[model samples]
Target: MFIAAYVLTGCMHQPEPVVTPIQQLNTERYMGTWYEIVRMPTSFQRDMSHATASYRLNADGTFEVVNRGFNTRKGEWKTAVGKAKPIDGMPAGFSVSFQWPFSGGYYIAELGSNYEYAVIVSDSHDYFWLLAREPRLPRWLIDRTLARAHEWGFDIEQMIETKH
Candidate 1:
């Protein structure tokens, strides 16, 4: 009984998963449109294709976030307008709210030096997205980034390529 108790306690005390964002992010350069190259399946984005996100900085330093995608099943375009509030002292972190009073973490875990590509994750590491300035990225780069996501505890196998 003591052995079982010790094992159960150890299991309950496991550390939370860690995902580190880049040290710095230039919001200005990060603005504009980014095409979604791949992402973990999300209910709201089901059957989405040609997914894209646009960022515009507001006067108050928050960001106006617009996400668009073509729904294959519905044969129409869908868009969601939201706000991204940057977390002070966390250059790569933001709280994005699509539905008012309910926000989720938007962290840039990996970013290219030139801002050409970026890997995004939430604080819980449940949401993952691979974005690029262009519609498509080189196969090798995608593979490398996916590998990095795996290292960060993401389930890369569940990632679905976005059609653009």
Candidate 2:
């Protein structure tokens, strides 16, 4: 009994698996600018703030991805232009190329009913970003978004709030 109690108390809790991408995503409906609200610290976005992403569907069925942010240290805006190609059979999944010949997985984990907010996660399980159509989301919407993300097994505690 003591050993069982100890095990129960000391064991690490596993994070639940995330749900599959939404049944269908209207890529056209998702195109536009989105401000980053929270995200994981990563080399790509290090020391940046006021981050925003824009998407534009191309005639070739690919999409343009532009990431712009202000470097805190330099106090200047920096931009990275990338391209995204949809992964076959996955409505919300894309392979994004920041440079030629190299692409990484991008998944739309969650999207708001009106396309007002989105939770994006990398296939590597290493990157996450909470985005909104506006620079800041309403408190209630933020709470609702967080609750939904928590239910889907995202570690909310690991999120770093993005300063605008």
Candidate 3:
């Protein structure tokens, strides 16, 4: 009776598995500026336009992220800074936080072979971002990437393209 009860309890309490990130990332190659192609809505990004995100490696082996964009309605440029620490066993995912003790999962689901583009999917599946090294990508590539994202179970239609 004790053994059966314990087994049943364990099965009911298992946590959801973490989504996998792209393997064997060259963090150095992944650094630098990436133009925001499209993104799923988030409170912080509401009312923003021409959005861009930049990454820089820190001496302490972490990373700094600067997200900037123009707020059309507000008629101003806005910027937000955050830091990310790499998660063990996940080469392309990090625990990112804009404020202390409040980190969120940042994972790269797909990346271009030449590091020209990347797709980031939040652990909660509530956020997604499509980014590229250039502000404008060829139409075919954008369509292809979005197709791939759809195959991977993300709602591609929910992503809104950025002006830049």
Candidate 4:
């Protein structure tokens, strides 16, 4: 009796395994007040103070994000509202598209266990934010958060410590 051995070959072309997307945020709990502790500088908020963000979930299944800051130079409050949506399968991450259909990646990389603080990031990693429930965070918390940010590949030096 003669026995033959067969070899099996697998295709080299295989679809990349998809990363499990971030968790979708519970808008209700996410709503309320958030103070800016630090963020990547942007023209829109070049000169601002008392910076705060307020969110309200609309019945239409969208969040009404109101960003407010006091312009020291202008001596007035600046406010803007932009629609936000999840980027494909990213749950905790979203794309805040101020101009319809034009979106920018906004990812929530870390959040405080108590929902008092959160770290937001952009796809480019150039944009980042340290947000808290109050204008100032506890020293220990700030230090801990900063350490985590550094570990997460953020340029801690670039983070602008906000007054408000």
Candidate 5:
């Protein structure tokens, strides 16, 4: 009886699994300046204000990613240049790393039909961002994105609203 009870309790307390939708990323449409409207907090971006990311296709078939932001703590601007390459055998899937050799996932989970906004996810789904060309996105679109994120097992409440 004790063993059965313990097994049942463990099963009941099992964590929910994460599910992600198959991403259909259009590379041409995705290359542009994206204002970071919202994001998940990370150590690299801590104390950052007015953050933005830009992507451009390089002649050598790699992506040049530029991340810029103002460090409120340091009272100066911070910039980082990174290179990105598509994950093997995955369409529109990419991995990015900064000056260091280590890399991180850069999956384009959802993109606007008109290239107006994009939702990106990391391999673990712990990091996420909603980016757009302009700082202000339409309310309806934001709602739609949140709904989609929920469907994909992401906790939308964790999203941090950014000023830029």
Candidate 6:
């Protein structure tokens, strides 16, 4: 009875998984183009394919974000320009605004050592994206990155791979 009770208590005391963002993000090194490898679906990006996000650092330490993608149904390319500002005390956190007076959280939760790939998540945890420097990533790498997202308590079952 004691052993069973102890097991139940342990099971109830499991710690919540924490999302750890990168500690030191070099904005200079990160300034470039990144192809969307996979993402959790959202209305804003509906029917988007060959999606890519390009970043350019401004002299005042802000970043210009240009998100481009092809609309499969419309047979045309779409683009949105936004501004990103670093969040104080959060090395990998930024507030991105595409429209006036409206912004959203953009956090670099996980990144490759050489900045080859990155896992992005928002404050709501509903938005997740996997990005890479190149359009195509190795199958093994995709699998591994998805596994890591799962470990971080994200629902990876609905992740959709982007076509590039």
Highest TM-score among the candidates is held by which one? 1
Give a tens-digit lDDT track for model 4, residues 1-164: 00000000112221111122237566578778889888766666778778887777778666666778888899998777776554556666555655553455556767777788877766554566778887899888877877877777777877777885
Residues 1-164, candidate 1: write the lDDT tens digits. Answer: 00011111112121221477778999999999999998877777889899898999999999988888899999999888887778767788777777644566677888999999888877555578899999999999999989988888888889899988
- Per-residue CA lDDT of model 6 for 1-164, tens digit only, reads 00011111112121211365678999999999999998877766778899998999999999988888888989998888888778777888776767655566677888999999988876554577899999988999999989988887778998889998
lDDT of 3: 0.71
lDDT of 2 by residue, 1-164 (tens): 00011111111222221356665898999998999988766766778898998999999989888888888888888888887777777788776777655556667878889999888765434566789899998888777766776776777776677888
Candidate 1 stretches with Cα past 4 Å from truth are 1-18
Model 4, residue 87: displacement in angstroms? 3.1
TM-score of 6: 0.86
Query: lDDT value for candidate 4?
Result: 0.63
TM-score for each of the candidates: 0.88, 0.82, 0.85, 0.79, 0.80, 0.86
Off by over 4 Å in 4: 1-24
Top model number, lDDT: 1
When summed lDDT is taken over every stretch of 10 residues in candidate 1, the lowest stretch is 1-10
RMSD (CA, Å), each prediction: 9.8, 10.9, 9.9, 15.0, 11.0, 11.7
Cα RMSD for predicted model 1: 9.8
lDDT of 2 at 65: 86
Question: Comparing candidate 1 with candidate 2, which one achieves the higher lDDT?
Answer: 1
Model 5 RMSD, rounded to 1 decimal: 11.0
lDDT to native, each model: 0.76, 0.70, 0.71, 0.63, 0.67, 0.75
Off by over 4 Å in 6: 1-18
lDDT of 5 by residue, 1-164 (tens): 00011111111121221334345666767887888877766777778778788889988768888888888899998888777777766565666766444566666667777888778776555667788888879888888888887787778888677765
